[model samples]
Target: MEKLAGMLKRSREDWAYCARDIMGVKLDSEQEKILLSVQHEKMTSVTSGTARGKDFVTAVSSLCFLYTTPRFKNGDLISNTKVALTAPTDRQVKDIMMPEIARIHRRMVSKGFGFMAGELQSYGIKTGHEEWFLTGFKADEHNHEAWSGFHAVNTMFAVTEASGVAETIYDAIEGNLQGNSRILLVFNFNRTTGYAAKSQSSSRWKKFRLNSMNAPNVLEKKTVIPGQVDYEWVNDKVSTWCTLIQESDFNEGEGDFRWEGSCYRPNDLFRIKVLGLGPKESADTLIPRYWIELANQRWQEFVKEGFPRHDVLRLGVDVAGMGRDSSCFCPRYADFVDTLKMVHSGGKANHTEIAGITKVTLNTHADKYTGKKAMAFVDTIGEGAAIVPILAEQGMTNVYSCKFSEAATDSGGNPLTDLTGQYEFANLRAYLFWAVRDWLDPSKGSKAMLPPDDDLLQEATEARWKFQSNGKIIIEPKDDIKKRLGRSPDRFDALANTFYPSSQEAVAQDLSGVFF
Candidate 1:
């Protein structure tokens, strides 16, 4: 107990020393710098790679901030001091940060630190007298109201996973900053335009960038403390990253292997998540921004006259399934394409409603192109499987079930081939996206038209593509794109399906089907 008191007295002068000697928390060199910066700087922003001990640093810093600040007049404990810890989600606050805080608090109590007294609860820690407390809350746009009423002269407000939190939530947290208070934001810099990214350039903020390669043991090649056993956790992390880089194919020929393999090709997912750098613009996006602008321009010119008549009209329908995503229907004839119409139900749209919409679109186009069988391509995944047969039963026999995961085949049931005469492409999803690229290619003499819709334009420009080892093209999956964009690109999916070849001759027959 005497030794604990002496250490506690010493900690009032040096927080980093206290953490290392008293708390037994080993911080790497980068983490040590960050800890010190948080203590001194008004705002500290840390962008780091995965598994870099960010949580551990945050936990120890909370304790140090509480222990070193001036105490209340009534007792030895720090008074009127509040530490607010928040994240993008409730699960992140309750499951990740709160546990780490509790663990550190328990360790301090076990070491006979008499000055520290707090009940370690699931939500937060409240020291004796309730004057000093560490609280956790979910900070997103929906829950911004919960961040109110925290006003303290000595306060440290910290946010974990700041990249995922919406800008409005960050603004709410910032509004509470008052005299002598500090703010800390830590995240794996994922997106190009978040509050976390914007803060990096602000003169008031001190920023730190760290990655697995710069881990404590990895950089020093030995333990910092004498008699400290080597765990090799840092070494394992570096090895895993190195293997992924070494094994990835660089067939895209423009960016690094990590960028090519990423779902957001040529973007900074690798630089931000693995190298701890700022976000970079995607170089090899599936659909260029200019292409979408040009397509919209072409549509404006084409719409001057009424819908042009053609021998065949194709309709592409993407069902809403459970209605979480909008159901989209796109109809096209030659160079003229109709604007996509998206519908939604409060919940899942009934099959009757899906089939009714599909039938109406098909019948209207079929009447326009009289004596011709207008083909309708319906996505046959999930609820779509039931919608296809319902459309056929409604006398729309020309409807074809387009399974995105199925093997790419021509209209004649022959395997589809790329320009290189080798079967390349993991599935039909890739084939459809490539077809969209070809349709928009000005060099091909195919003047395509599209609606002037910003949502569709954004979706088209953000889609990414990669080439396989055998030189086959692959499109980023919708689920992966949804993670980055927060919603599925349903309109773009329907548009791509419209570009499916109507004749077997459109795709080569001599190439062999090589699945990778």
Candidate 2:
């Protein structure tokens, strides 16, 4: 009891001490500085390189303040302290921060701090007082109003990976900076001109910069820090990303030249990735912002007038059970797509849940699409494959199981070709994304339309295309995309699956009960 009291009192003022001693987490010099800075500074900004524990420091410090701040009298908090930890999106929060929070909580419980954090809820940590707790939020960068409305005696806001975050989110935070409040900013320092860059440059924040050269592990050429950006990893990145843009020192513009025949920026990739510096721009994105805006404008114009008549009702299911990502459902009528619906699968997504939801959605849209026209294209890779036989047994002939890892083929299972009849489409995933690209290309006179969702738009544009030596065009892998963005592009993957050519096949002839 004496030791507990001492730790709690020190924890109120010194978060680094709280983390190292209380949580048993080993922090390098830079990480310790971030935790200490968060206490005295109103805004502590960290522009960290890859694998530098950007998420870890923020999560630990926030947990430190959240559990130790509240003074309880008969189970009611003396100061209604509220910690709102937000990422660019809800999925990012769930995937990056929440898991870190859970891990820290596990460590705390093991070391005996379960008494402070009463219960771990789906959103975040809960205490005796509902108003006095820490929670993770999903912010629509455009809708700053929804992100507001928490004014407490003690308020803390932590934003992870602020690169492309909407300025409106910062505006919302400005509104709530009252009483004993602080802002914790941790990100990759990815850009030169965004709000994230401003956080690094502005005098309002106490900044800490970390990169490959300074990492203890890289210097010692061993496991100095606990992450992957060690000596061997840095050399690997040099071999892969630093090849085309060679220079005496790792700096900007060295990699502006072409590597092989691809137009990808190898140097800028190294700059933002390894050196922890921002590029002039994210220059290699496949889709343009203007084209997406055109699509959004097109959707609005169509909404002003009633939607045109289209018969087939198509649905795409990106299956994810537990483990950070959510299962998303995207429904469309021929060319016009509807808003996406996603469910948080706290456990494994069994056949019953997905099938029942599919049946329910089909029944709801029964006015226009029925029988052969109502098609549910389910992603049948990994967790999805288990549901295939069960879906077959359910006799939902309209549902087709699609394996994204399979080779790209036409409705007749022949290899795909480009405009000039050359080889194209490295895999089924790439083929679907390319089809989505075509559907969303506003320059093609706006043939198809989808809901104007910011997350959807961000996911669609973030994907870049690369060409293989064999002349096959491929979209960036899902794992790689997940690394850049905090979670799987679940929403966009759901959108892309709806473009499977099996829709035309279903219209032609219903080939039921077989996995594609």
Candidate 3:
């Protein structure tokens, strides 16, 4: 306790020292009030003692004028506020506030203000947390009811997460504001991290919870609920629960099915988008220009640029029980049915169709004179299992076999280890996993990157399938299409593997010929 007290004292002294520096700069009375308000907030919870502490507090207090005390416009305030408030103890506030602390905080608040103003102009605030509350933005500079109404819900969050109070506080916030109509809740999970708020809970609040309400536009009267909201008023509660589950497990596919960052989500209310192949795309769906773009601007600038793309081949195929969908084909086209006790249906492809796809892959992608590098990725599950190995044997060594299930069995068709660890059939799967997971951070824009084709992009967007608590990317058959598209993303798996092999340890011997 004594040691902690001493540190606090030092912090105060440091503030005072900064205050002295701030006083040296020129400033007027309105600016002084804003600065004081800021200082008061900083000092309210802290002990103000020692010259250093006093000076530090005084300096920050003066800087607050840049926002509220008016003579300085927003631009002038932002430009000089950092210099005015350069107190050593300021860094101790937290990581998020360390960089452009004032700027980001101001931006967050300003953005919040703009958003709320837009809401008011179009619709209006519904009340409750949606009263246009600001979580991490500081309001010490101005006592104006307009800005003050924006509470620091996330400051409490900062205090709570440290004490493992997140679960409890999160529950309280949900309980307190869940049913209120026209109310917006700004839940801040990453406030202290300096990164803009991005988390499962934040995503849920923005996408599922807030969006679910039938609030009017910002120009209209805010929606009002006389009493607590009935639980039934919500749609897709199960989906929200699933989103929370996704966040806890670090599911990566964002935008479309769900998103962690700035990706669009699918609304059954909207029609699906169809992309056609143009000069950049072949009837085979080969995106050569996209590949060249990825290799040039993104990769060559960063990683070993000239890694010889001529050798990389992509194989495309499908996986299913030996059957045909009634919607797409005759049910009688189903060659066989399932023996599984749990309502299983068998799927087998007509040999003629499989031969055709295989022949096309060979002609379009694998000819020696094509001089382009790439492979054909084929789905290796169910009906696909029957033909992938045969393709591999037919000198298509780049034939990537897909095994979607971690509980999948061996060649003898018996369950073995998890799917990610299954190396017995093809080493390519392992290589692909590392390439996506280890090589790239989806947010930072990777250089050694290959943009996914429309099909791959669709799968990547819909891949709501994620790791279980045990850290495995679990993809259930039923939910696979719901999250990954109309079918299991077998083509995506093969392409991902070929482009970003799981490992470069043992190169396929056949690949040596492509180097020439």
Query: Residue-wise lDDT of candidate 1 within 375-494, one digit each (tens)?
Result: 777777877788866765655566776778877776667766654456466688888887787677554554888877766766776678888786767787788888866677887888
Give candidate 3 misplaced runs (Cα > 4 Å): 1-311, 319-348, 363-374, 392-400, 406-445, 448-456, 465-487, 497-516
Give the top-scoring candidate (TM-score). 2
RMSD of each candidate relative to the true structure: 16.8, 18.1, 22.7
Stretches off by above 4 angstroms in model 2 are 73-75, 243-266, 280-516
Span of 10 residues, lowest total lDDT, candidate 1: 507-516
Over 4 Å off in model 1, which ranges?
1-6, 74-79, 114-117, 220-267, 282-516
Candidate 3 lDDT over 1-516, as tens digits, reads 696446334434343322333223322232233233343332111111111112222323422222222222453421211111211122222232233234323343453323211121111112122222212222222223322222322211111111112333333333322111112112212122111121211212221112222222211223232121222322233233223333333422222223234223332221111000112222222122223233234433433443333332344444345443210110000111011111122454554456455555456644454464334444454565666555554555544444444332334444333324542322334334433432343332333344323334444333323444654334333344544244554434543434423232123333434421
Decreasing lDDT order of the candidates = 2, 1, 3
Q: What is the lDDT of residue 413 in candidate 3?
A: 45
Q: What is the lDDT of residue 489 in candidate 2?
A: 83
The lDDT per prediction is 0.70, 0.73, 0.30
Preferred candidate (lDDT higher): 1 or 3? 1
> Residue 415 in candidate 2 has what lDDT?
81
**Displacement of the residue 505 alpha carbon in candidate 2, Å:** 84
